[model samples]
Target: MKFVHRLCVLCLVALLLPGGPARAQSQLVLAISEGTSGGLDHGRVIAKYQDLANVIGGVLRTKVSVVFAREFATLESGMKDGKFDFVMARPSDYPARGMRDNGYHYLASAQPDGQCLIVVPKDAPIQKLEQARGKRFVMPEQVSYMSRFCRAELRDRGIDLAKENVQYVREQAAVTFYLDNKFADIGAIASYSGPARKLDKDGFRVLHRSVAQPYFPLVAHARFKPEQIKAIQMALVSLPDKAGGPEILQRIGIAAFDTSGEDRMNVLLDWLEK
Candidate 1:
């Protein structure tokens, strides 16, 4: 199973890789829109993906803003009515990405990248997702992707989840207690939480990772003029690790981030429509 997953990821990356040829000029106010509790809040989600924008801003000497989706439905209506410029929303919010595809365009990561882990107490017998059925699954208050992420595993195992097989608990400490006290068979987590120290390396093992998409991307909007888009693209293709990106990734937890690929997230679009 692990091998199959790895193979899928590799093939996807290979297919979407960006070709050689650097864009000249780099300076633009690329905005980032993500999913959160309220409507598109570009102000709040900035700190996270801003690591990339900061690097781009420094190297190219540009400005950027981070935005969040407004109640999910507003994704399409919002971007269309106004210019969002750039966004990093979820795979589930692909419709807004598409309102500008084809001649209209957008970029998304090859990975269905979002972090949510089903963790159990360190010394538990749940080594695989199959063992998680009929057991409690604790998640965060705003974790909406659980069903989409965990569905395939359930279907594969033939687990009957229709009759409340999985109980959804929303609380921070509740999740921690469930995992730490052995109350929860599984819990989901954001990958940013401390690596060895936070996740209690000694306590738990990751049974499954919901890495079906690339980490939410720093994508360009359709309205961006060619030169403007090129500048942003150049910055992303070359981050802290790249010569011109200006070093900021290290200050944050990010080791480095770069992409060479097609600006297509259609698979996500197809899924969102379903």
Candidate 2:
């Protein structure tokens, strides 16, 4: 009788995995949005989340896999296809449209809103955005949330790039290097890029700083049961207290999982719809 029950459980898990489950463990896919913030190494980015996934998997008694779609369109399509059981997306790519059009549930967010900095040499006299105008600019690629948010804010402040030499690189480190080497007059870097350390150690100064803004959000698909979702939420919220949790959270730069209400999502969706 016990053997029969074990066989039934294996059968159920087999139904969940692609190509027919060869293993008894249930598989969960945790998808991360592709960005330059983690550098261009896809393997490194995937590995970082694998540790977090292992903890979540241990909590849920399942196998978790981490993946990132290389392009926005691919991520959108994968969401629609229900390829991801959970997702970690940038603010601009909040999976808002997916939440409405598809069936994703807002789970939690990484605490402490992100900030952007317009940095120049510490010795440079550029004290404000206006002073940096018409100067050579260096920034991450347009696909980066850092670039998208910072660039929009820069334009709103009347910083014209058409008149200045602008260079977009694939990594945030490149932006700092360009500024440090005197190749660019100013650099736009996100707080996630470790801007504070760069400002202090690299001899750069903030010419302007952006208002606090929402950072990345984590979400789950409709396939998760309410109780299962709650369990996952609880696990993430308590991650900092678990063994080795502090190290993992620090490496990921998440202070804690803010499992607050959905008010933030509503606001984010409203902004996206507009």
Candidate 3:
């Protein structure tokens, strides 16, 4: 699996090189980052996104190759150096940075915005954000984007995690374990995360639902002209209306692409950085 993954990644990178048949052909590189710690492997990522890449290629009249970035550092460096012609990623902050500091323009975001859910045992006394103060909090690793997101949400509610009793885990599922085993009083996880889906079944309840923000944003590099960006944006927004579009969306795990998140995307880093 490792060899196959590396070979595929190399093939995609080769498309960008000069002096080959691929060089003579017009091509655009689309960098995709699910998140540094996301569960999907390279093969799964390609299967999920190749169709959308084909659609984008058709619209742009160029070959669109997909590159899966499994690490945040690689994604950030690629954006900073203008290595990716387009990017669509989750944990939104990475793409948000691409737009704010890397000259990328927000094109669209996936529907059903992401929220941080503060979870606790169903019988726990924490009924509100204020009550969560001083309680042992379990969340994803401090370096993970979701951790930053949850911290930001808690901070906004006057609950500073830095001052609170907290347990940083490597996975969201571990957050649930800490809560279940009585190792923590409260926990945080993304609403779309795996553990979040089983909250009710596992006898946990959402103590607080943080504010929704744009999720899985798609942005175009500054190299694209305004008209090109507009075209790409429209194509993505109208994807669901086209034939096979629904299947494409199902494969990609989003209902539709929203083009109205430009404002939210613009201020996302500010909110997270605060």
Who wins the TM-score comparison?
Answer: 3
lDDT of 1 by residue, 1-274 (tens): 9999999888777656543122122234444444443432455456555666565455445555444564556555555654455555553334335443523344434232444465677778878787777787666553455444444334444654454335555544456666677666677654443432366644666776654444555555566576765666666555644763344454333454434334334454444234
Candidate 1: deviation at residue 93, Å?
A: 3.3
Worst 10 residues of 3 by lDDT: 17-26
TM-scores across all candidates? Answer: 0.61, 0.72, 0.88
Q: Return whichever of 1 and 2 wins on lDDT.
A: 2
Error of 3 at 187 (Å): 0.6
Give the local distance difference test score of model 3: 0.88
* Alpha carbon lDDT of each predicted model: 0.52, 0.75, 0.88
Kindly list the per-residue Cα lDDT of model 2 for residues 1-274, writing each as its tens digit: 9999999999887777775755433588888874434454568767678888887687778888988766777678888999888888774355665677788987777877667788888898788788876788998886666777676667667875556678999878888889889899999888766655558788888888886555677788998888888888898888888898888888776787777845656565553333
Better of 1 and 3 by TM-score: 3
Ranking by lDDT: 3, 2, 1
Provide the lDDT at 107 for model 1: 44
What's the number of clashes in each of the models?
Answer: 23, 0, 0
Candidate 2 has an lDDT of: 0.75
TM-score of 2: 0.72
